[model samples]
Target chain A: MIPAKFDYIKASSLGEALTLLQEHGDEAKILSGGHSLIPSMKLRLATPSVLIDIGGISEMNTITEEGDEIVIGANCTHHQIATSDLVREHVNILSQAALCIGDIQVRNRGTLGGSLAHADPASDYPATVLACEATIVAEGKDGKRTIGANDFFQALFLTALQDDEIITAIRFPKVSQGTYQKFFQSASRFAVVGVAAIKKGDGVQIGVTGVSGVPFRATAVENAYDGTSSAAKHAMDGVDDIISDHFADEEYRSHLARVYVKRALEAL
Target chain B: MNISITINGKLVTHDIEPRISLSHFLREHLDLTGTHIGCDTSGCGACTVTLDGQAVKSCTVLAVQADGSEVTTIEGMAQGDQMHPIQEAFREHHGLQCGFCTPGMVMTAADILKNNPNPTEEEIRHGLEGNFCRCTGYHNIVKSIQHAAEQMKA
Candidate 1:
């Protein structure tokens, strides 16, 4: 499947990427690992006139600590996140989710920033990020600003990113206990229904993905959680609009959401 | 656009379209047909290859994206007709059927062995999740990788 012809530029810096994006307006798409974008392009589902290849911007790839948060560069691949000692120590749930993203090949090339920016409803990171209350930083011609995970994901593949914006980094506070559980789609390896649950301070936080048009925090499930299966059974009490796919019907997806939530919460 | 990359330890550059996938570039332009392509959507890992020492699906990567990096395809595994140990193990264990998925399986297995010189059956299976083989039911593939691990360790 050949992607449509388009002009390509490898940005040497974040500034260059932003400038190219600003100049091209809505016609420019930023390329990170190309794991997500390239596949979409090959399908002809996306036809951007210009490809701003940001994969070469080495400065945007780092995992570090700042104050109380663990900062991860957007260009950091799933394999990096899955194997990073800092990520494993700081937020094990993120590593666990990264580990299960696809097979070894996918993990080696898929980028965290790209995954979050692409904002696929079936993607794994949004669930853990929403559960952990991570902050996403977006940089543009003006400056950089942070978006809460809950607000970052809008719907489907939609995000709050402006055409010129680029995700620079995502930061998460150190967490002691967290887990991601999912029923996977065999072929794409995407989640059929996934849950990320974390014990944060006095309460349990949970996020549900692949069962909605967007990945969302299941506050109802979090409040109903009592370390028991009954709480998970009632997880969908307040949530509406469960998604159905060829792989699983709505009823099954809802059921898996509750089942996985139970397993994740119980694991935590 | 123009890009340069090292494949099989040889440096090559070309003026190419931005849309050309790495799998196509390797097979068509470089004639390294040992790297196969199946389900270019990243589902089938038949196009697996080493990029900077990490296995990635060539179908999911652009030739332009691989610029300035080192790539290792199945063709690069052997030296002067001496098959790579993993290749030898595959033959000895009858690791392949139809042979469409061998190049990719071997590449991914190379990556697994590089990270974990000796892996348990479960680990080998886990590492092979991306590389699908519709034949052999994966029993012999696992055995082949197990044998390769022992041979590499020896």
Candidate 2:
């Protein structure tokens, strides 16, 4: 399927991409892996006049250790993250979540920054980032700013990024223990209900996605934790906007969230 | 827009629109029809190809996005008259029925075996989760890849 006719410019660096984004405003869209945007474009859901291809930005493709956190470039592919030994050692749940996203072909081309920027409610990284207390870094004409994962995702297909800004990297705190449990949609391999639980000292940080319009940290469940499985009961305590599709109804998704939360807690 | 891609070890340049997908570029521009387009939505793995040595759904990849990258389609798998080991195994083990999905299956199989030279039956099945085979119920397809792994190892 061909997308709508649009101008394409390959940005070799981050500064060029930012400038292009500023030049086009909302008419231009940043192209990363193009797994999501291209498909949307082909379906005519997104018809940008120009595509700023940032797939060649080498600076935004490195995985490094910055003090206490593991800094992952926004352009890092799912296959890179899923197979990275550094990610496997620290912030392992991110790796776990990365592996659960789509299939091998999709993983080879999809990017972390692109996925988070797209902010699909069923996306895997949102759950992991929220649960791990990761920070998302966005750069614009002014400078770079970090937004906590809690405030990054605004709504379905919406993020805290401005039209002129692009995600440069995601910073995740090193965690020794974490688990991501997901009930997948059979055809697309998207999460029907995905719950990520990270053990933090005496408490657990729980993030839930695919059950609601916005991926959120399950604070009620974390607050209710007392070293037992009973805390998983509050998985949906404060969540109101539940998604109901043919793959999973609201009630079924709610049930799966609690069940997966319990399973994640048990695994932790 | 103008883009140059090393497809099947041959550098091909084209002046095309940005919306043209790599699958269309390979089929129409280069006349390399071995890469089949079963599902344009990236659901079925019929359009799988190796972009810089990694298997990706060509339908999801724009022709412009693959500029300066090395892409290997199913047409590049064989050496002249000799079929690739994976193709030979598929023929020997009856891996295909209608053969519409063969090109994609072969390309994905090459990637699978490339990553894991000695993959178990379960591993082969997991690696092939992206590719679909309605015929053979994947019984013979799995057997073909399993046999291919052994042949490649030896």
Top DockQ: which candidate number? 1
Clashing pairs in 2: none
The residue-by-residue lDDT of candidate 1 on A1-268, one tens digit each, is: 9999899999999999999999999999999888778888988989998999888888889999887789999999999999999999988899999998988998988899999999888999999999999999999987999998889998788998888799999999888999899888987789998898899776799888889888888888777766665678766776777788789988988888888988887787
List model 1 lDDT by residue over B1-154, tens digit each: 7889999999998988988999999999999999988888888789999999999999988999899899999999999889999999999999999999999999999999999998999999999999888774589889999999999999
- Cα lDDT tens digits, model 2, B82-102, are 999999999999999998888
Worst 10 residues of 2 chain A by lDDT: A229-238
Tell me model 1's lDDT, rounded to 2 decimals. 0.90
DockQ-based class of model 2 = high
| Number of the top lDDT candidate | 2
For each candidate, C-alpha RMSD in Å?
1.1, 0.9
Clashes of each: 0, 0
Off by over 4 Å in 1: A227-229
* Residues A84-194, model 2: lDDT tens digits: 999999989999999899888999999999999999999888999999989999999889999998999898899999888999999999999999999999988999999
Error of 2 at B46 (Å): 0.1
TM-score of each: 0.98, 0.99
DockQ, in order, for the candidates?
Answer: 0.91, 0.84
